[model samples]
Target: MNNRLRTTLALLSLAALAGCRGDREDAPPREFFPDLDTQLKWTPQGRSEMFEDGRTMRQPPAGAVPFGRRAGVSDAAWASPWASERDRFLRDDPAYFDGTSGRDAAGNPVFIEKLPASVSVDKALLLRGQERFNIYCSVCHGYLGDGKGTVGVQYSPVAADLNSPAFLVADAPQTKDGYIFNIIRHGKPKPDGSGGFTMPPYGHAMSEADSWAIVAYVRALQAARSAATPTTGGSR
Candidate 1:
């Protein structure tokens, strides 16, 4: 055979042998690049010799403001320096945090009488409120906000009827928007005093804005039902 033909046959035989790699159980495969084997990175807490400080983690520069901090924000939004617990509480407005309307001259705790100015009653807010209410609240309060939800029916006492005039009044009102907001933020208190949760607190689950949205959606339901039904004297 010619030298070229002999060389070609040898090369073809080697190529055929390479193709049989990893075909048998005893034949372990090997990677020329081994990309995956070398791709692992050091964890945050892991030590490294790359820096003089010997830290894989990076430290923020001095006086660097945290993400999303607005310049000249309200004092209530900012934390006071070296403030005590009582002092911090005093700094926070009761209407905003605890959802209270302060006190009456008789030394009784007065619940909120109106909705906060911060809550806008526009279409967008109402829609968002409705969406949140249906997802988190409708199972307990019903889509109509009539406290006839399936879960509530299983309980000894049904959920609070948001359509009730005592809570959601039309021409005249008694309960404040803050009262409803408070209820949504911190669930209803259980009578047993077991210290176990009654209605699960959504305050930890949802944002303050989302809780207010639910309140708005509830008011929307009330307004819709009241509009549909005819009223006789002061009774519905």
Candidate 2:
């Protein structure tokens, strides 16, 4: 063969050898661009030398407000849903979000006597409340709100009987809708001011709407119980 033909054949042989790279091996494959293959990233709970605390995750800066919607966003037709969701996240309404109209003279929260205007009492809302109650509160409060749940019987003080006179009476503080809502979300702290709760807070697992819905369902249960036996009171 000519020198050119020999050179071409040699080049073809080298190309064929290069194609035999599919064999699996224990060692990591060679990376032509190491920077792209091995990127610099901080995983969750990973250590970092850059920070003084040597933590990959950093706390939010002091005075840093939680981000919600953009500044220019308005309650226009197209942006109404977005604005509503942002407002819910912001929790700017005291009566609706915090379940308190204002604080009393002694700095104690003054819960609203009735449900806030934002919450509409309807069949759909009651159904939602029933579902949420069964999932979260029923374990301790019981499906009937009688504090006779399987887990509730095991508790030291036992869960409150939601259908009792204390909660259903018109003049009783416990009858306040906002009070119930707050209890459902924040839970009751020990009377001694010790950093402990009688009822664990469900705020983390549910949204404000769902919490309010539970309150509504509880009221419905009380009403049904009252109607079923006009003269008979609910037992604790």
Q: Which candidate is the best by TM-score?
A: 2
Cα RMSD, each candidate:
15.9, 16.4
TM-score, model 2 to reference: 0.63
Each prediction's Cα lDDT score?
A: 0.70, 0.86
Per-candidate TM-score against the hidden true structure: 0.53, 0.63
Error of 2 at 25 (Å): 77
Where is model 1 poorest over a 10-residue stretch in terms of lDDT? 80-89
Q: Tell me the deviation in Å of residue 89 in model 1.
A: 12
Q: Could you tell me how far off, in angstroms, the CA of residue 53 lies in candidate 1 after the best superposition?
A: 32
What is the Cα root-mean-square deviation between model 2 and the actual structure? 16.4
Model 2, 26-100: lDDT tens digits are 898766558766778999799999999999999978644344645656546866666677777787789989889
- Model 1 per-residue lDDT tens digits across residues 32-101: 6687776758889999889889899989796443333335333452343423233334545566555567
